[model samples]
Target: MRRDIGGVVRNSLLAGAALLAGCAGTVNAPYPPIRADLSPAALARGATIFHASCEACHRGGDAETVSGAPLRELPSYMGRFHASNLTSHPTAGIGSATDAELARAIRYAVSRDGRLMVMPSYGMGDADLAAVLGFMRSGHPLFAPDSRPAPRSEFSFIGGMGFRVITGNEPVERPASGIPVPPKAATREYGRYMAHDVYDCASCHTDGYSPRKTEGDDVFAGGMAFVDPEGRKVHSSNITFHETGLAHWTLEDFTRAVRDGIAPDGSVLRSPMPRFRGLDAVEAQALYDYLRSVPARDNEVKGARPRLTATSVRPAWVAATGAETTVQGTTVGAPPEGSATAPGHGPQQNNVASTTSQGPAGGTATAARPPSPGNASDGDGVTAPASPAAAQGSSVNTAAAPARKPRPAAPKVDAPKLFVQLGCASCHGPGARYQDRLAGVANRSEAELVRWVRNPEQFLPGTPMPTYAELIDEPTARALVRWVKAGGPASLSSTSR
Candidate 1:
């Protein structure tokens, strides 16, 4: 009888082990169909969403960030975190992942191997879901197949307990049907979708743990707490229509703030606040409309740095420099393969590498690029000059610029603009590894900061930063550093900068 009982117990244990194995992968399976599209407009929308949401963590390095390249660390996560390669490479990326798998991962924050992740976005509407995925799979140069290798995330003891044990297997209801999004337009409906569903705007703007909200009394009113990649606690400012928020802000002010990282009060926005230079005018206006339409909240966020104080304002010394003052700009993180605008490709030495209709001060600027040998630009250092008729329709087919007439090279810009337009922000921008270095710019004396800015190689040898001593004068560098020292960089693009 004792032997019989032992056999039964052994059988029960084996059965339990088999059951656990089966349950793991099926936890978030049977992902519904999204019916994504590969249209140019869809690709553009995907690029926009990717820029606003995914670029911060999934970046490969300081160079033009290729999507799907793995990053090894996150801010204070106490884990060997590696942002998974999101590219479509057959082995190195998510190329093998089925559409349903992608859907489940996005919806449930579950990894392909069944590990729960802490993704900022989950369960977007169907239209947007289709567009974003379509763009990723459309073989665009940014998301095209790449075989770069990086390690996967390895959680520590505490992290394992927090994510896997406590929050990992929570029983949240999955959507039985597809979520719906608004029509593409400059309307509040689409704007709401952008803020909540696609890329969460309040992720940093909220102080609470549950920052993601679809509809709330206080969405963009601020008080969001963020720990930068360097493990610093950064305060998020209120951005509502209240006097304490954006009550005094105009559309142009809001546009410049997002595109250039400058504030209405003249203070520069700090790092971790994404600078989205490629954000189109329609998207900007739509987002602004939604923010204005939200209920006014009186929360005055504190501990936020670079508040544009009277002391931190542009010093009078700028006038003595006898050079022009400048402001900010940038493009999305991902650049197409062989892109002329990619870092090391464009005329960055001139301090004016790119031009966009989206200007630093919320104006339009036609790019004057060097002429390519052929009639069109084939990912070369050229933009085919459009005729009057072609320029109007450029909005529809904006992603691809093929063979066209060549334009002249752009004239040189000032040193301050060079800092952003030349891609300096990628290494020092929001959540960048070296972002901590910018704080010293505010603390050090004028001459010290100026010296470092003029020739960063002098302060730190073997640095990758380009030397600007020849381009900028002592007074100019001094004034420029003082002017921008209040805030850290967000991001600058090769195309938009």
Candidate 2:
């Protein structure tokens, strides 16, 4: 090969310049100039909003990955990924971010370098965004004093590289400032604000979120799937006023379901369902009103109950930790030894389980809040605290140690008759089959079935299926599981009314 010395030198210099440009690209630019209110009332409102919206994910929400770590260390995808800290700590949190920078992060998910952070762009009015910034500015760091880089896998950096290349790290365009907010009323306009900005109901209930998602799609026709800690699938119910949705539900029914986690059908919502007990009365009413106002889409989603029972399989990330730190899912760390649940915190709060589907025991459910609107640090996609009743269900097993020998098996029972009588067919309905829906049940021993039927929530912390202990005798429940595994002898005549 002939050496072109001058050409090589010229190319080297160009390469160096390119490298410098790349490095500079990662440096976040100063935020655009903007003024914001920092009044105490605004700050207090921000705090309340934080607790209602941001606290689930950032405040030690992921018990496995972010546990024992500072709140600044936000967890995403369980503990595998995380968002930048929002606390007012110069080193670890968004303390250095300018007010405009913070706004951009929330409204656009862009970093100082104009890099896209995995955040949702909330279509919030300016006042609401300003309040969030004010709250963040006044807030002190609650967890870590020093900042920590988010945990990463080998491909994480590569993924980031791809994102920057694709997005070009363009800063998010700011929305109009000083826009008027809807008055806190039960009117549809205010209800829209509460639903989209305050409680973020549409983000959870609908499909994918984008700048244009709200304008185009049928909002609140729920189809999101939330997996419980025990690996059961509970699809977000259709809240639209369609027959397959919440057409029959009253406003009172909606309130009880959101505030209490109890469905009108008498079933308890599974874990990861944050029963917003602290939701303001007005806000709750507004949300209900907004849901009713939206056009109903008849999306017939099923598996609104515990269907999957996974076998013991640990996650790959868990191998590094050794011990199987199961919380909601394959958690990487344990909660601080005396880490008590925050007062008024739901059962789903601080259950640091990982959401990854892989690892030693297939990735189990982990708790993390979804991103909040106009609040970059807030929101874990699966935000919802378990209800008080669901929380109590978790401790039932801890009180007693199990006997080594399994209990006596139940006698063979008729499943077809039992299924009809107990209304199992009601939710499972006509077309549903045990072969596809029922998981991990056929293999469970009679003793196991006895424990499960008696109190599924006790064994599986967030299962939505009500306990059958009261409905059926232990022997019958055991026999029922056995018969279900064998394939119910009688097929349903029609869908349960």
**Top lDDT prediction, candidate number:** 1
Q: Over the stretch 1-497, how does candidate 1's per-residue lDDT look in tens digits? A: 99999999998767655543332323544465765668888777766666556665666444243444333323455466567677778778888888767776766667777656555545577767777788668876555666875476655545444443434354235573557777768999877777666657765565554423424677777876566444566667887777667776778667767755555544446556765645668888898999899888887777643233223332111122222223332211111323232122232222422445343444243443554433344322235665665555544565576764333242323434545543455556555566666766667886677667655544532233444443343434544565567562543333332
TM-scores vs. true structure, each candidate = 0.57, 0.49
Q: What tens digits encode model 2's per-residue C-alpha lDDT throughout 1-497? A: 34698889888777655543452365343443444558887776665555455555444432312112222222222223454555555655665778887776666666665655555555567777777777666633343333554342121333444444544555434453555678878788888887777667776677543434455566787766555433455566667777777766667556756664555443456445554544567877888777887888978778553221223221122122223223112232322323332233322322223333333323343322233332232011223455465556644554477554221222223456546544466445455433245556667676776566545544433233454432333334555666666666335565441
Candidate no. 2 TM-score: 0.49
| Clash totals in order | 11, 27
